[model samples]
Target: LLGTVLLGARRFRGGRNPQPRRAPPSPTYRERGDTTESFPLDFTAVEENMDNFMKQVKNLAQSLYPCSAQKLDYDMKLHFLENSSVTCNDGTPAGYYMKESLGSRRWLIFLEGGWYCFNKENCDSRYETMRRLMSSSKWPQTKTGTGILSPLPEENPHWWNAHMVFIPYCSSDVWSGASAKTDQSGYAFMGSLIIQEVVKDLLTKGLDKAKVLLLAGSSAGGTGVLLNVDPVADLLERRGHTTVQVRGLADSGWFLDNKQYRSTDCHDTVSCAPTDAIRRGIKYWGGVVPERCRLAHLGEEWNCFFGYRVFPSIKSPVFVVQWLFDEAQLTVDNIHLTGQPVQEGQWRYIQNLGIELRNTLKDVPAMFAPACLSHEIITRNYWIDVQVKGTSLPRALYCWDRSFYDNSRNNKAPPKGCPVHLIDSCPWPHCNPTCPTIRDQFTGQEMNVIQFLMHMGFDVQKMAQQQGMDPSKLLGMLSSGS
Candidate 1:
């Protein structure tokens, strides 16, 4: 209702977009098909949507980085061009495939990484390090094969051979400026479109909606995950009350979605927000720099959405495989839950899995692989998967970890570099040798947070819903007009 009521039928007022709602609809894979790409921006806010809280989040993100960032001239910006290629490979007209197998396994709709639509945006050192982190934190080169994931290749017995689709966040035609407004929600449009295409094709091909997996890389794609997952769940649940859980959510050095550092947002929290994560992200992801240098492109500097408040509800099981040393985008704030840092990567990974199982047992199975991973190390995990066993499960927390340094966030080395070559290794074989199998520079042997998840089952959503939990439930945040 927030995005709906605020954005009604007016022209984009500019500045930050209000919430977001249905434009009038002409309205598919069934989910994105239902989404219409006609809406305006709303610069009409005395305060951000969440008001005080949004200010706090943005300030927190901004304070983490201290260098003077380049301010947007605003005159140099671009919008949806009448002819910009916003339609090329919109992620539609594609089929889902297993990254390593085929024949009849679970299917996944994956997206590629490329944080900025403009190749020029990669100039930032932090952005570059984030790219390196992606090599480990997301689909590996050995696995995805030059960006095109091999759907259901007949190689492994456990290969989840099923229909899968890969959606690229920025269309080949979208160019750079097509979405410099409203927090890049336009990218969400592309993601939704791809989801629509994949769904229609899947249904037409006889695949069950409940069996679909939604995956994205980096921030824009991750935002797409937020936009698509819940809607996909709604569609699948409509078809089969017992929907299958989405298996893996490959997030790599993702820090700018939902909530990011911004002006007028993190006013007070700026002084107290945790700096360790930012420092660490700067250390490991910035490649000798800090997050500010990386995110300098964002003129608004608002934590529009954070992992704590953005992860969509999973109809099926889910997996979150992050790195132990990634430092691209650091923060203790949980952007996925919409606003719950307490439920971040491992925490939310656990909480969400419980929620999924509570919703369905066999249909949704949770799994995880820390891969001794980090925000930037995701792409490497795919290569590490060669040593990782079992299919990617839905358990919230699973696979890899080590806290060599007590308070690992700070006092850590810079986000210098990573083993970016791992992405090419096909389904890195599962072999969790006790010592750093890949001769990893980092070390920690904490695997399988299943028991912890089972234990959290007692609280999970109920606890999250509690008034004084972690973020100290807003109580009225979700049910307010202003």
Candidate 2:
């Protein structure tokens, strides 16, 4: 019982568990730290023993500190920026949702993800459809943080106690615009400015005393982190906050500048899309790139928008979390996935996309790149389940955090069994057992073994008919490669 409690306490205090699938043969009972006994385990006795141990611990804790029993509220509150110049696309007052943890000196500012509008037609269409993202008028007064921003300890193990800040995406500029409303566009694109203003506002609200600040974002916002992380650190340093260590966590933002399966002359179609979008949107939004990247690109500042292009210029440490087969990238490349099987050429193109992602992520010092076909991660409820080489995302993040501090203290290496750079080397999708379930968009049903085989460029229907067997029963003969 004491050994079990000690192990639990060690894990709670941030120790590596390293629970891999297979274990090597033990040398002996003494070497394994066990005292073998010949007694049958009693289910009722075990429960009673644990209950009595917990009760005793609880009583001792109360006697040691009577005031520790009181619970604290960690509900998020809405706060609008006091500055009038900082506004959204619709000219509404810019704001952010914050969940304060008075005891913690750490801060996590998360930028929400919504795709950008490149031109006036796109902005006009967005205002008509996704008004909530374009305008902050319809935003809820209060919200409960979930996923990485979750206040619950069970959901977010590492940063749950930190002060959480959720900045909604309202600028429609991929969080890089610096221009106000224009006569031609008739919408303010102050995304970069909004982030600056939020930090300035936070400085007056306990942020001045913060020790560690993690700037994180998803999708477009993730790209924003790459473009703006250094600027945030510069802002803090310029204002005399030199002690704070600023880091970035970008999720699903490592977009590749690759060619589509079918090239098209038209720029508006998915075959030739974001290339045109980035080229036009950079000027349309009056986008600002990092000084180092701007100096490097000179004539073409839009290159800074891509992760591989701008990542080299970023001095601050950042952790990239991207899917090997990103859904958004597939859609933009005109590779539409459905319930039906894909063509042979389409399968090859999809496989190349994963390879390209792996190649791009090779230099990233800290990242969790799983060979899955999904988009956003950090904000998903199942973020905990997704693993790379038996190390979950949360555990990888914990190890990365430790390594950062260890480096700051001039340590040579990270803790044993704690991996930071993890990537799925598998060649196919869903190759990792911890990969999330892939569902059909039209039917909203989980893809079964037949569909999975079909996705791998196999004509399962034809094979089943030829063998005089149902495709569903082929699971026994074939593996999903997981």
Candidate 3:
């Protein structure tokens, strides 16, 4: 019965409903120490458990939806960029998913993140990675968890029923470039064009009617939100949604200009010195610099690309979410980009990044700077539970939203002396256990899986049977891990 229903579901590609393709295999649990996990199951055992659980899911799905006539829409519907020529890094069609439901006329548009690449070689490598990691074929038809994109109201109280749009990143330009194709490289640097087209499409699809708009993204997408939020808001206002309350939330995209860590040449450590990449990106993509940003920075137009520099210039109230010791800086972009050793100096550099972030965004309406070492926090399983200063991250965000909207409606200044939600787990490098970490091995995979299921509105005891684990043991593990 499940097979019949699955076969009957319309599969969309390039606006055509094609024959159903074989569902992709479940993703393997590639362990990252920075990802907060609550249960420590053996890696192999987790894989076996996942396989068993998936089988049960299939069976349960079959029983729940016995009629093949009941069509199951893909969690994210694919809509290619309106322009015929623009495509992703791999030359595949670029697109976003609009998951509409009955809720507020408010909108929560999330920009998906993948890091950027500047030079031709780096761009080519990024293109290949996009093909592997972001090919439309790789996405799951059905999203099953909670947090940022969750459809369930219990999990995402504020945003569950809003017009939720997820824009995929494929341009390797952080959605800020619009370069003409050059003979030197075959890649299309049309990220700016992609953003323009996507926004236009959304405007036509009732985004002009949005009472509230929260433009948010993670990593590169987070940077994209900062770069494009004003333009997007302007587009809506011009379309007669002048009263629409638009705000931005940049998650883990509070990138800093760590010139202290980069080499003199500036070519190798472009990630650390993001302005260099931004300069190349602007020229390559034919992107426009925000006029206010240009005037604010004056001679330093490239500084507009870095968040710390740009945050002060944004007129819209944006909530900044970041970690004090972002694990990505420690492991991926910073040291990895510059070939710097993980010494005391590197630690100081990370701390300084946080300091600059705080100083730059001190005046922003809302900020969530946790002392965790993790990178992206909003979409992770831990977002619902992870707390700093006795307030869960989500709760803090909700409160911020309430305050922001209330202030906007009432025409009142934000209450003075209100503490910024800066959650520091202090003691230098050794993070507080309660703070999220991907570095610990004893972290439990089982707990992660259980929490994920709970977020999806599943019964843990029933799901545990599939994994050949005792439900009580799973609960205990989760308790201990927490």
Candidate 4:
């Protein structure tokens, strides 16, 4: 009982449990001095007691991935690590099943969101976002017909030449600061795998490192870019490993300093997503551990980044994008009542979360563009938006000209109407994921969810173009969400 309570306490404290705050400097056991078991297994075992629950998730990853109908590769590479303080590994974990596609020109890599192992049955929200991206990208088909600001339309997507790599979120490493059931083990291990193996494979296949980029959705991607970039950049510097460009889009990103934005606390004691939406968040898309891991449930790790904050390093210029009223961030915490109007408290909760996250990261010059988008629209994060309605306006946020990026573009007009506020926008507030709004309700002509994401993505692409960077890289990670 004490063990369960302690483990539950950890789970309640950390977003993924098992990696509790207290420690004897031990990796995951309840007792800081206890080093009686393997690192990952001990930390993770309690939360993940292999009892029918995990087998189901493992079965799911295997079953869903093997639909030869999809013409996919199933087996994954594994690596083991052992050390007193093992922060870096040669890539790969001891027991992981990875997904990769061979003979494709475009590489689609999705970063894991939570510290929990990727095997969670509830993490399916990621799929909802990815499916939208792949289907909308219309790549693997023809790009010429994509309709808007499509730059690479004439270029071949080279689907045959492309190979995709899945960043696993679990590990079976040794002597590391992790337990099998702990959350850190999953995210850290998965990120290490992506950095070590996926990137390594791309270089090995003669793919230009500079051209390869990684994308993430509804997830943190563990910010491996923080660690991997410097070392990999060093490798690129020495010509040892080719440079692999990584772009991170943390959808409804939860990594910002959690104290301010970790959902409002009802009792001044505990924080939560929102009482009204927490339930709906679970039943809508099958969110498991919703209560235990959801924001409404509001555990510690769900919002803490002590590890990353403590080990701060600027790896790649990872673009951390978000939508204004994100359901995934707020709504995901609880299940919402079906027919009721969104309550005042719920509204405040959602609005505060977005503003807090946005303000926290605004001045880093890391590249930020917010639209009047909602939760996680596929097109919103991927497409580019502009003041496209009330009046004719030339693109200022992103122009082919280099001066535009240096903030030299004159504030052309008093800024034309955005068109979003004018129309019954299908996506706004919390409707689209990667939205940014200076005014609370500067309404204008509105676009559909897909339209919004495309608008946002196009802007990102334009930024890359002005900066002289490749756009197709990591199309999966950052191009979608809410």
The C-alpha local distance difference test score for the whole of candidate 3 amounts to: 0.62
For model 2 the TM-score comes to: 0.82
Candidate 3, residues 1-482: lDDT per residue as tens digits?
A: 33443343322112122334445444553344225343321211112122233333334444433342145342757676677667665566667777765434667888878777767766666556556332454554434334677654345544554667887777777777666466876766667677778877888887776677888888888888888888887777777778788889889887775554645454532343556666776665556656789888776677777787787778887888887766555543455422222454555566576666556666665787766556787777667666666666666666666565556468466444334465553423223336653322344343243343243244557546955899898566554543
Model 1 C-alpha RMSD vs. true structure (Å) is: 25.5
Model 3 ranges off by over 4 Å: 1-74, 132-146, 260-272, 331-342, 408-420, 423-433, 440-482
**Per-residue alpha-carbon lDDT of model 2 for 197-220, expressed as tens digits?**
999999999899888899999999
Give the backbone clash total of model 2: 0
Per-residue CA lDDT of model 1 for 258-303, tens digit only, reads 2333223221222113332223222222111112322542432122
Ranked by TM-score from best down, the candidates are 2, 3, 4, 1
Q: Each candidate's root-mean-square deviation in Å?
A: 25.5, 12.2, 15.6, 23.5
Best by lDDT: 2
Instruction: Return the TM-score for candidate 4, rounded to 2 decimals.
Output: 0.40
TM-score of each: 0.36, 0.82, 0.69, 0.40
- Please give, for residues 89-146, the per-residue lDDT of candidate 4 as tens digits: 2122322122333322334444433322122322333334333211121212211111
Backbone collision count in every prediction? 107, 0, 10, 82
Clashes of 1: 107
